[model samples]
Target chain A: MEALFFEKLKEILEITDRELSANDKFKEYSEWDSLANLSVIAMIDEEFGVVIDNSEFKNIQTLGELMAEIKKRTK
Target chain B: MLLSTHHNISIKGLAVAVPSGRISVDSFYPSFGEDIVQKFSEMAGVKQITRSIDQQTASDLGYIAAKKLIIEKNIDTNEIGVLVFVSQKPDYRSPATAFVLQHRLGLGKEVICLDINLACSGFVYGLQTTLSLLKNSSKKKALLITADTSNKTLSPEDRTMIMLFGDSGSAVLLEKEDQGNAVFQFGLRSNGYKFKSIITPAGAFRNRDLPNKVEEWADGIKRSDYNTHMKGMDVFGFSITDVPNLIIDFLEATKTETSHYDVVALHQANIYILKQISRKVKIPFEKIPVSIDRYGNNSSNSIPLLLADHFEGKSQVLKILISGFGAGLSWACGSIAMDTKDILPIIITDDIYTQGDFKSSEHD
Candidate 1:
């Protein structure tokens, strides 16, 4: 699930050259933007069938947190 | 129950007009760099957009479309007893823009002239109000005009919006034909608590004073209090979750299914957003005609513009579902049954109401 999340994140964010780590502050990425944020939310929803609440999504900072939310929902 | 019903209101004709100035999304590559912009364009689903010149206003676009529709359909102008102009961008702050359009369109004082300050959800809401009024009154018809010059409100530095938003005006003619039991059903929703999700920080009475300095934010975009800002994350959640839920509720309440419609004229907000709505609601892609790839997001005008793009000049009957959601943090959907012969092909016009510039001073 983690690998799939990172892979999709990379693709959605259009981050080709660099690898995203779980600890990486995903929102701080140079490519990370409003479009990226929307894409990520959409990506999560599609991948995990989990609709992330707007406020909850905002509080999430790290890539690991996003993955964990998916984990919680999927489990 | 959020559902509202009106009977015997048939859409007589629909027309949309765009100003001659065209702005292509590809042109932004030079300023923002090729790679990122390409990604943005692909995600947002904007290729080129029709823009009204600075001298022109939203009502100008509305006027041309309304006139064309009136002339083409041979609609009796005198019978156009109600004119509702829906847009956030009005010509003047004082008089309702509908009154201006009413005068320009040769509508009389006895007519209903009003303005609705709505953006994306304008179409269904406009239809609900106009149809109800027409049904109650002795007047046989009401002209529902939704137009917006979104380009004017955008901040150049705010890349998220600059290219994605477009300008155009649309005119939908609703005739209260007391026959055939034509029924229109609508369900609308709003979240004022999340109103800040999409807002212009200044330039209104609430935020009247524009900051003298443009501050560079963490995103590196410089904007003052006057520019519009959209919280993409919040809007995405709203669009995918709230918007489709509203549609689903409307369908369940109305006892209709997504597959039942020949066309689902959803707002051309983004290609991704459109797809998400499709996935969430189970509406097929083929049934949803998109104009955003060519026209960008024309605010309230998107649904009608989508109709004019596909069903224009074609003669056929269609069971249609129209949904528009955004800005006001509002969303609405309506089921419409109409004949395609009533939908007019879009026309391009550069006409501006020059006197509106308000430049000349009286020699008193």
Candidate 2:
């Protein structure tokens, strides 16, 4: 499940899992703009059947945090 | 609810006219930065848009399209018993634009003329109304003109609207025919509760007190009371949630299956929204004809524009499912079965019509 989640995130963020460490920050990515933000949310919903509000997106900053949020929503 | 016309009325002709001025998304690279422009282009699924010049208006384009249809199809002006103009952007605030068109088109004085103030859903609703009028009355013909010059109402800095809308107008000629092959069934709906999801706050009487000045909003977007504002996330949610269900209900109401129609034309809101609707409705993406990549969202004119663009110079029996949803928070979906001969090739013209410019060829 972790590998699959990272694969989807890597595809969305346009990075390889080798480059996407848990500590890697969204701010570090050049693609972290409004469009990517929405794309990530849509990807999560489409892949996980979990709804993430725009407000909730700001609370997570790193790859680890985003994964945690999705894990909680899946739970 | 599902509704079907009681009498047979055939669509004899259809024509769309867009202004000759074309603006490519890449043209905005200097203004919006290439990165943002590219991102927006990917997200909105718009490549280029046609815009009317200051000298042209929605009525101008619609007039041109109607004239072309009437001339090319050899429709008699005196036989057009009704002229309905469906637009959110009319030529004037007082006199209905349809009345102006009646005079400009040289229709007889007895022709009924009126304007319906609607935007995205205007075409389907206009088609339903025209079908009902022709079905109940002795009128043999009606001209339904759906147009939008909504590009004029936009703020270039408003990222939500600026990249999404284009200007266009279309004319559809409907004639009463005995045992005509046209069969129309419709599903219409509106939710005024979510009206604020898309609105122009200042031009109307209720919001007239507010100043229409563009101000920098959050996330580098700018807007004003005069400009159209849309809550992008809310609209996306509403469309994804409502549109698919509407299509499902419409199919059930019309007694048809998803695979029944030859083509489905949803309002050219954007490629993203249309594709989402198609996916949710379980229709193949190829079945949904998309013209937004070229014309942008021309509001009510989009469905006919899609037909004109897709079926131009083609001849075949077509069962088409068309849905239009937007402003008024309104939506209408319907099925129309017609022949390709009924759809005229799209005509792009820069000609701005004036009084006496359109004379019946019969007079010549």
Best by lDDT: 1
Q: Pick the candidate with the highest TM-score.
A: 1
TM-score of each: 0.95, 0.88
Off by over 4 Å in 2: A1-6, A15-32, A49-75, B2-6, B353-364
Residues B1-364 of candidate 1: C-alpha lDDT, one tens digit per residue: 2789988779888988988888898898887888768888888888888888887899999999999988888887888888999998999987989988887888867788999999999998999999988888878889999999988877787788888887889898898775777788999888898889889878768866666467986667887667777877778888888888899899999999988889999988988888988998998888888889988998999888888888877899899999999987999999998899988778898899976666548544
Fnat, model 2, is 0.14
DockQ of 2: 0.30
Cα deviation at A45, candidate 1, in Å, is 0.6
Where does the lowest 10-residue lDDT sum fall in candidate 1 chain B? Answer: B355-364
- The lDDT of model 1 is 0.86
* Residues A1-75, model 2: lDDT tens digits: 667777887787677535567887875687677667767766776777665665566677887888888889899
lDDT for residue B119 in candidate 2, whole number 0-100:
91
What is the per-residue lDDT of model 1 for residues A11-67, given as tens digits with 9 covering 90 to 100? 887678988898998888887776677777888889888889878987899988888
**Clashes by residue pair, model 2:** none
Model 2, B1-364: lDDT tens per residue?
5465545777888988989889999998888899788878887899998988876889999999999988999988998888999998887776899988998889997678889988999999999887776666666999999999898888887665777788989999988887755567788888898898778888878887798678986756787788877766666666666777888987877678889988998899878778778877889999998889988999899899989889878899888989998887888888887678878777787777555244687486
Per-residue lDDT for A10 in model 1? Answer: 85
> Against the unseen true structure, what C-alpha lDDT does each candidate score?
0.86, 0.82
